[model samples]
Target: MTARANTVAVGYLHALLDYARARGLALDALRAALPFDPSDRDARVPEALGAALFDRAAALLEDDALGLHVGEQVRPGHYGALGFVAMNCERLGEALDALRRYQALVIDLGGVGLKRDEQTCTLSWNPGTDGPYRQLAEFNLAGLVTFARWMAGAWAKPLRIDVMYAAPADTREHTRILGCPLRFAQACYRVVLPIDALDAPLIQPDPAMRELMQRLADQQLRALPRGDDWLTRLRAQIARRLRQPPVELDAVAAALALSSRSLQRRLQAEGLRFSALVEQVRRELAERHLADASLDLADIALLLGYSEQSAFQRAFKRWTGQTPAQWRAAHTEPRN
Candidate 1:
């Protein structure tokens, strides 16, 4: 399918809006600002619009730590399919695995990353390389910590928390809410927790319920729109259908529910061409495929929609001034 706009599910905002309402903020003003009905839990808005709303809400409430408070208010229901799956997992580690796999069901602002060592494991939210996401970052980290506490216990605190943004004028709330050592202006947003904590059993663990939720989550993930903008959506569609025959303009247009002419027009509007876009997608996918050592050159060529290894080699050289094998050799990690 075609890539869709970078959007955030409205359900994620429910906690923030409800938190505002609880604090005596009027609903009418915010409701009027939204393009869709606030009660339409399945609705989504552009990522930029979501950020604007957060800024506006902070102004209206006159609270700088609004994002943290809103995150504190998040319930399992706010996370949609991901929440249910996490709730039913056998242990905290399984629940975290569910979160890592299904985070996009809640927000596309960034990805969830987990790193482990013998003593502790670090769970981090890596926001997109570009964007004004300070508040959203705060919300994400806060929500993750809060949800873990809810599932486990109050004592299930992180060893420390790392935030990407600089320290605000007052961090008392940050300390109070996070309940851990805090570091600001860090390179990434993350929380370090004892590995044993992840082994703790969840309060609610249902294997049957987890299975059902996983199926539903998979379907939702497949149906969700692909990316942050139209071009991204288009590129994603191309990548998905690359291995299938005829990854042409018309085929891609039809996949996105657009006509060939309309798709051409949209690309032109962005000062891009359909052929150029396809080539770009190929270049990107080629690099990614090459990173995996198991895939042979012939397999990589076919995956990129090339009919012959020689032709794929020529394109790779033209794109990167190096043969595919050479590129792979340079990038691949050395064997231990």
Candidate 2:
């Protein structure tokens, strides 16, 4: 799974899967669609597919600030070796610096950049190439800030959260997740911290663990494949537009602010067809939606933008060789 540079660590996927299951989601449907063993903690997956799965989880949960929730939930173990490396650093600054270098273990998309002023030391994320990743960017930075607080103590919340996009209609969730006021339509996505927090000692400093985690992280990095930023962005867009049916090539292009012809040319360069990507998104979401027993097949069909239940059934059959009910019955876990 970690063969391609385009892949993401399966730990991230597993976390989302766990989150969904805790919320009473249908785990069987997710497995039937993605077909991965939950026990494979070290597995890697294509970043696009992973992003699509994450997006699908968000849609099903109906939480727009789901990234914030995910970020705030980050514990040292969730990041695997990288988390181990970060948490073991002696100082918060060293932890942040280590995170900047080893982040590829958790995510391959972005890097951390630092800027210091008289009062605040800004930590900004240089996001991988742009698509609709505002939520993800926020999630990553918020998690980093949370880790920093863990090292520096819980009172050390960020002073500011500079988000690039327009302010979401609801700021309450952001306030709760970030524990700070947000600055919308900013130059980019970055968080501000009072400079003194950097020197705070970690609660559990371990130089020996840091060395071990660093070596393990390097080995994991070597095992991952090369990536395509554009392709990941395209797939993420496809996931988002699933709720808005008739997910056509042109519509996807328009959403990304490109012409249809240009979109095709780019996808062709990646050896992808837009139609194929649409099917991939729908198939993934169909499995996700079907996981919620309260959500019948008819409701799922509409969510996937199908005009009718019959059309969705035909497509699901063609894609999986079984009806949604059959797939769910086969994959769903037995009740206790």
Which number leads on lDDT? Answer: 1
Report the lDDT tens digits of candidate 2 across residue range 72-100. Answer: 77777778988888888777766766665
**Model 2 misses residue 14 by how many Å?**
2.2
Which segments of model 1 are wrong by more than 4 Å? 1-5, 31-33, 228-336
CA shift at 160, candidate 2, in angstroms?
1.3
Indicate the TM-score of model 1.
0.65
Number of clashes in every candidate structure?
A: 3, 3
Clashing residue pairs in candidate 1 (N, C-alpha, C atoms within 3 angstroms) = 3-233, 4-226, 6-228
Screening candidate 2 with a backbone cut-off below 3 angstroms (N, C-alpha, C), the clashing residue pairs are 4-225, 5-225, 5-226
User: Model 1, poorest ten-residue lDDT window?
Assistant: 125-134
Error of 1 at 114 (Å): 1.2
Model 1 lDDT per residue over 1-336, tens place? 332345788998787788878988877767645667788888877776776677778888898988888888789999999999999976787778678667878887444556656899776653443554666667777898899889987536899998777889999988988899999877667788898887788899877687688779989987877634555578789899888757789989998888999987666433355676667678768977897888999999999988999999999986555899997876565456
Give me the displacement of residue 86 in model 2, in angstroms.
1.2
